[model samples]
Target: MCDDLQVSYPKDFKWSSWHVSCTCFLMMTLKTQSELITEINNGQNFSSEASENFIANTPGNFNAWLSENRESLEKRKSKPYFLEENKKFVK
Candidate 1:
Protein backbone atom coordinates (compact mmCIF):
# COMPACT_ATOMS: atom_id res chain seq x y z
CA MET A 1 0.00 0.00 0.00
CA CYS A 2 0.93 3.66 0.04
CA ASP A 3 2.27 3.14 3.59
CA ASP A 4 5.03 0.95 2.10
CA LEU A 5 6.32 3.99 0.21
CA GLN A 6 8.60 6.44 2.02
CA VAL A 7 6.36 9.37 1.09
CA SER A 8 4.47 11.30 3.71
CA TYR A 9 0.89 12.57 3.49
CA PRO A 10 0.10 16.23 3.79
CA LYS A 11 -0.29 17.45 7.36
CA ASP A 12 -4.01 18.01 6.87
CA PHE A 13 -4.71 14.50 5.59
CA LYS A 14 -7.51 12.73 7.43
CA TRP A 15 -5.45 9.53 7.54
CA SER A 16 -2.94 11.32 9.73
CA SER A 17 -5.29 10.70 12.66
CA TRP A 18 -4.29 7.05 12.66
CA HIS A 19 -0.60 8.00 12.96
CA VAL A 20 -1.22 9.94 16.15
CA SER A 21 -1.25 6.82 18.26
CA CYS A 22 1.98 5.60 16.73
CA THR A 23 3.58 9.00 17.32
CA CYS A 24 2.45 9.03 20.94
CA PHE A 25 3.82 5.52 21.44
CA LEU A 26 7.17 6.57 20.01
CA MET A 27 7.22 9.73 22.10
CA MET A 28 6.89 7.63 25.25
CA THR A 29 10.31 6.13 24.51
CA LEU A 30 11.92 9.50 25.23
CA LYS A 31 12.39 11.17 28.59
CA THR A 32 9.72 13.54 29.90
CA GLN A 33 10.35 17.29 29.97
CA SER A 34 11.25 17.47 33.68
CA GLU A 35 13.61 14.52 33.42
CA LEU A 36 15.39 16.07 30.41
CA ILE A 37 15.88 19.33 32.30
CA THR A 38 17.23 17.45 35.30
CA GLU A 39 19.61 15.44 33.13
CA ILE A 40 21.01 18.57 31.41
CA ASN A 41 21.39 20.30 34.78
CA ASN A 42 23.22 17.31 36.21
CA GLY A 43 25.50 17.27 33.15
CA GLN A 44 26.71 20.78 34.01
CA ASN A 45 28.50 19.52 37.12
CA PHE A 46 30.77 17.49 34.86
CA SER A 47 31.98 20.25 32.49
CA SER A 48 35.75 19.93 32.26
CA GLU A 49 38.63 22.36 32.78
CA ALA A 50 39.13 22.07 29.02
CA SER A 51 35.69 23.55 28.41
CA GLU A 52 36.47 26.59 30.51
CA ASN A 53 39.86 26.81 28.87
CA PHE A 54 38.23 26.83 25.45
CA ILE A 55 35.95 29.68 26.42
CA ALA A 56 38.88 31.64 27.72
CA ASN A 57 40.74 31.17 24.46
CA THR A 58 38.00 32.81 22.37
CA PRO A 59 39.36 35.98 20.74
CA GLY A 60 36.38 38.31 21.13
CA ASN A 61 33.58 39.37 23.43
CA PHE A 62 33.39 37.67 26.80
CA ASN A 63 29.62 38.26 26.63
CA ALA A 64 29.47 36.13 23.50
CA TRP A 65 31.46 33.46 25.26
CA LEU A 66 28.91 33.57 28.08
CA SER A 67 26.02 33.43 25.63
CA GLU A 68 27.53 30.41 23.96
CA ASN A 69 27.98 28.69 27.28
CA ARG A 70 24.84 30.02 28.94
CA GLU A 71 23.03 26.70 29.08
CA SER A 72 25.95 25.02 30.84
CA LEU A 73 26.30 27.94 33.25
CA GLU A 74 22.58 27.92 34.00
CA LYS A 75 22.73 24.24 34.74
CA ARG A 76 25.74 24.78 36.99
CA LYS A 77 23.89 27.60 38.76
CA SER A 78 21.07 25.23 39.72
CA LYS A 79 23.36 23.04 41.81
CA PRO A 80 23.62 23.83 45.51
CA TYR A 81 26.65 23.18 47.64
CA PHE A 82 25.88 21.46 50.93
CA LEU A 83 27.96 22.30 53.96
CA GLU A 84 27.55 21.69 57.70
CA GLU A 85 27.54 25.41 58.46
CA ASN A 86 24.61 26.08 56.08
CA LYS A 87 22.24 23.65 57.84
CA LYS A 88 19.45 25.24 59.86
CA PHE A 89 18.25 23.65 63.07
CA VAL A 90 14.50 23.07 63.14
CA LYS A 91 13.04 24.57 66.32
Candidate 2:
Protein backbone atom coordinates (compact mmCIF):
# COMPACT_ATOMS: atom_id res chain seq x y z
CA MET A 1 0.00 0.00 0.00
CA CYS A 2 2.75 2.41 0.96
CA ASP A 3 4.74 1.78 -2.19
CA ASP A 4 1.71 1.94 -4.45
CA LEU A 5 0.60 5.19 -2.88
CA GLN A 6 4.16 6.54 -2.50
CA VAL A 7 3.98 7.18 1.24
CA SER A 8 6.22 6.62 4.26
CA TYR A 9 5.41 4.04 6.97
CA PRO A 10 6.95 1.59 9.35
CA LYS A 11 8.70 -1.29 7.57
CA ASP A 12 8.73 -3.68 10.53
CA PHE A 13 4.98 -4.23 10.62
CA LYS A 14 4.27 -7.67 12.00
CA TRP A 15 1.98 -10.29 10.51
CA SER A 16 -1.81 -10.18 11.02
CA SER A 17 -1.63 -6.45 11.81
CA TRP A 18 -4.96 -5.59 10.27
CA HIS A 19 -5.08 -2.20 12.02
CA VAL A 20 -1.71 -1.27 10.55
CA SER A 21 -2.79 -2.43 7.14
CA CYS A 22 -6.07 -0.58 7.46
CA THR A 23 -4.35 2.62 8.50
CA CYS A 24 -1.84 2.32 5.73
CA PHE A 25 -4.59 1.62 3.26
CA LEU A 26 -6.50 4.63 4.45
CA MET A 27 -3.41 6.76 4.16
CA MET A 28 -3.04 5.64 0.55
CA THR A 29 -6.14 7.61 -0.40
CA LEU A 30 -4.61 10.80 0.98
CA LYS A 31 -2.13 12.93 -0.97
CA THR A 32 1.54 12.07 -0.70
CA GLN A 33 4.47 14.37 0.17
CA SER A 34 5.59 14.54 -3.43
CA GLU A 35 2.10 15.61 -4.47
CA LEU A 36 2.11 18.39 -1.87
CA ILE A 37 5.50 19.63 -3.08
CA THR A 38 4.32 19.59 -6.65
CA GLU A 39 1.25 21.60 -5.68
CA ILE A 40 3.46 24.18 -3.95
CA ASN A 41 5.71 24.46 -6.99
CA ASN A 42 2.71 25.09 -9.16
CA GLY A 43 1.64 27.84 -6.80
CA GLN A 44 5.09 29.44 -6.94
CA ASN A 45 4.95 29.36 -10.70
CA PHE A 46 1.57 31.00 -10.64
CA SER A 47 2.91 33.72 -8.35
CA SER A 48 5.97 34.15 -10.54
CA GLU A 49 3.91 36.10 -13.02
CA ALA A 50 3.28 38.76 -10.43
CA SER A 51 6.98 38.83 -9.59
CA GLU A 52 7.96 39.06 -13.21
CA ASN A 53 5.53 41.87 -13.79
CA PHE A 54 6.96 43.77 -10.85
CA ILE A 55 10.44 43.54 -12.33
CA ALA A 56 9.22 44.52 -15.74
CA ASN A 57 7.33 47.63 -14.60
CA THR A 58 10.32 49.11 -12.79
CA PRO A 59 12.25 52.15 -14.05
CA GLY A 60 15.96 52.09 -14.89
CA ASN A 61 17.05 53.80 -11.67
CA PHE A 62 16.72 52.13 -8.25
CA ASN A 63 14.67 54.82 -6.50
CA ALA A 64 12.51 55.33 -9.57
CA TRP A 65 12.01 51.59 -9.81
CA LEU A 66 10.99 51.37 -6.15
CA SER A 67 8.67 54.36 -6.45
CA GLU A 68 7.13 53.19 -9.70
CA ASN A 69 6.57 49.54 -8.78
CA ARG A 70 6.00 49.78 -5.04
CA GLU A 71 2.24 49.40 -5.20
CA SER A 72 2.35 46.62 -7.76
CA LEU A 73 5.09 44.76 -5.89
CA GLU A 74 3.10 44.86 -2.68
CA LYS A 75 0.00 43.79 -4.47
CA ARG A 76 1.82 40.89 -6.01
CA LYS A 77 3.21 39.85 -2.64
CA SER A 78 -0.32 39.96 -1.20
CA LYS A 79 -1.71 37.69 -3.90
CA PRO A 80 -2.38 34.22 -2.43
CA TYR A 81 -1.30 32.16 -5.38
CA PHE A 82 0.13 29.51 -3.08
CA LEU A 83 -2.65 29.77 -0.55
CA GLU A 84 -5.33 29.27 -3.17
CA GLU A 85 -3.47 26.25 -4.51
CA ASN A 86 -3.01 24.57 -1.12
CA LYS A 87 -6.71 25.07 -0.45
CA LYS A 88 -7.57 22.73 -3.30
CA PHE A 89 -6.55 19.71 -1.18
CA VAL A 90 -8.55 20.86 1.82
CA LYS A 91 -11.21 18.26 1.33
Alpha carbon lDDT of each predicted model: 0.32, 0.35
- Cα-lDDT of candidate 2: 0.35
Best of the candidates, lDDT: 2
lDDT of 1 by residue, 1-91 (tens): 1132223222222222222234321111233455556658888333233222222122233234445655765577442221122223100
- Candidate 2 lDDT, tens digit per residue, 1-91? 2233232222221223222335433221234456557768887333322321222221234234335655775677463232233333212
Cα lDDT for residue 30, candidate 1: 36
Kindly give the stretch of ten consecutive residues in candidate 1 with the minimal lDDT sum: 82-91
Off by over 4 Å in 2: 1-60, 78-91
TM-score of 1: 0.19
Error of 1 at 47 (Å): 42
